[model samples]
Every structure is written in C-alpha cells, then in structure tokens.
Target: QQQVKQSPQSLIVQKGGISIINCAYENTAFDYFPWYQQFPGKGPALLIAIRPDVSEKKEGRFTISFNKSAKQFSLHIMDSQPGDSATYFCAASQQTSNYQLIWGAGTKLIIKP
Candidate 1:
C-alpha cells in the first residue's frame, strides 16, 4: 500500500514540446506527494508537489496534476528543453511514518535538440 508506481521508464521529447510522467499509489494514508528531479551524479531536488486536498500545482514550466480520489498524479513539463532532460521520481509521505517518502521508480526524460 506504500508503493508509488511510475510509467514511461524513458521518454523522448522534442525541444519546445511537452513531457508528461505519471504515477499512482495505493496508500490512502499518504498525505504529501512530491516530485523530484535528478541530474547525473547529483541528488534529487524537489521540483513540484501537491497535497491531497489540492487538485493541481504549478511552478514555472512544471505542473503537477493530482487526483486524490483516484490515488494518482502526473507531472507535466511545458516547453521541454534539453536542460530539462533528467530523471524524475514521484514519492509519497505520511504524517504517521515520520514523513518518510516512499518513492517511485525513476523516469528518464530526454529532450531532443
């Protein structure tokens, strides 16, 4: 019930196109959902997030669409760029577990120039 499943293990997008990555979880106890972006040889960094109460959250070119009832969420990258090429991970955390994040397998995105 604590697992987050991600899809499209790898994606290729033309520059200026949109890149979308999806994830699903089975744990209703999860209260915090955050997406992380990681570059090679570096730790992941918070990209965007949404609470169970929020349907959507956007930051710059990144947007997260959440469906609390469906236990699903997706990340959309607007105007994808080569610089945006990286691995993305979706994670969930609950207040009861000391806020430990249960992670989704990484999605590797490549923006073709």
Candidate 2:
C-alpha cells in the first residue's frame, strides 16, 4: 500500500495526441496522490495531484484521476507536445507522513513530431 507501481516504462505520443498511464497501490492508508514530471536529469516536479476527497484534479495540460476504492489512479496528458516529452511518475503518501512521497518507477514519455 505504500508503493505506486506504473507501467509501459515508456510511451510515444504524436504531437497533439493524448497520453495515458495507470498506477495502483496496495496501501489504503495513503491519502495524498501526486504526479510528477521530470526532464532529462532534472528532479521530478509536481505536475498535479488528487486526494481521496476528490475524484480528479487537473493543471494546465496535465490531469490526474483518482479512484480511492480501487486503490488506483492515472495521469492523462492532453495535447501532447514535444516540450511535454519527459518522464512522469505517480506517487502516494499519507498526510500524517508529512507528505513524504512513495514514487512509482518513472515513465518516459516521448512526443514525436
């Protein structure tokens, strides 16, 4: 329940397309969910997040949809761009943990021109 596991390792999307990836967790105690975006060797930056209180959250081109009962969540990118090509990670943590993050293995996204 403490780990968020992602899949596909990598994804390729054409410009202006949509990208989607899934994640699941075993720990129901986790309440905070966040998605991060990283470019190259840069540190992951928080892209968007949703808590158990909300079913979804969106920021600009990035969106995170959550399912509390299912213990799953997903990240969706709309209008994929070359600049948006980067690694994405999903994370989980409890507020009581002081927001310490449990990260998913990074997913490399490539937006082909």
Candidate 3:
C-alpha cells in the first residue's frame, strides 16, 4: 500500500524492557518494507526490514514481524536501552518504484531509567 500508518505516536518503556510498535498499510503492491531509527539531530538510518515474502526478520535486538494477509507489521525491541530511545519510522514501497518510501507519522520511543 502507499500509506503506512503507525500507532502509539509515542512510546515509553523502561530500560531492559521490550518495546513494541505496530503499523498497517492499505496497498498490497508495496514490496519493500524497512524500519528507520532516528536520533536527535541525526538522519534516520535503515534499521531493519522484511518483504511480503518473509514472515519475520531480526537484527540483533530488533525484530520485524510481518503479516502479509493482514497487511500489517510490527517492530519489537528487545532489552531496550536508554540509548535505544529514538524516533522509529515504519516504511513501505515497491521495489519497481523509484524507492520513494511511504512513511508512518513517526513513533517517538523514550526509555525511562
């Protein structure tokens, strides 16, 4: 889908806890999925992604669980740390397209001490 909608607009988790964020899309043509993590004064970097072809993808403490039939996906942060607190964005796009990402409104994650 062309639109990726994310929720909880903001999240607060204690250090060493698990943080979860969810997203949904309307279009199924979108073939590429990526999550970007952004910190203050810095550009978002590709955190991790999963295509419709895969059910889940994980990178270290970050995991992306996707549901193609439901047109939804979620990000799970394990052992969240204060340093992990940042704005996370869920994105989707078609590989055939020019790589224009349809982004979520942005979820601000804050880990409390």
* Best of the candidates, TM-score: 1
Candidate 1, residues 1-28, lDDT tens digits: the string is 8799999899999999999999999989
lDDT of 3 at 66: 96
lDDT of 1: 0.96
Off by over 4 Å in 3: none
CA displacement after TM-score superposition, residue 41 of candidate 1 (Å):
0.9
Per-residue lDDT tens digits for candidate 3, residues 1-113, read 37789997999999999999999999888988899999999999999988899999999999999999999999999999999999999999986678789999999999998
The whole-model C-alpha lDDT of candidate 3 against the native structure comes to: 0.93
What is the Cα-based lDDT of residue 2 in candidate 1?
79
lDDT of 2 by residue, 1-113 (tens): 57789986999999999999899999888988888899998898888888889998888888888888888899999999999999999888987888789999989999999
Off by over 4 Å in 1: none
Error of 1 at 10 (Å): 0.6
Which pairs of residues collide in model 1?
none
Error of 1 at 14 (Å): 0.6
* Residue pairs clashing, model 2: 1-26, 1-27
TM-score of candidate 1 relative to the true fold: 0.98
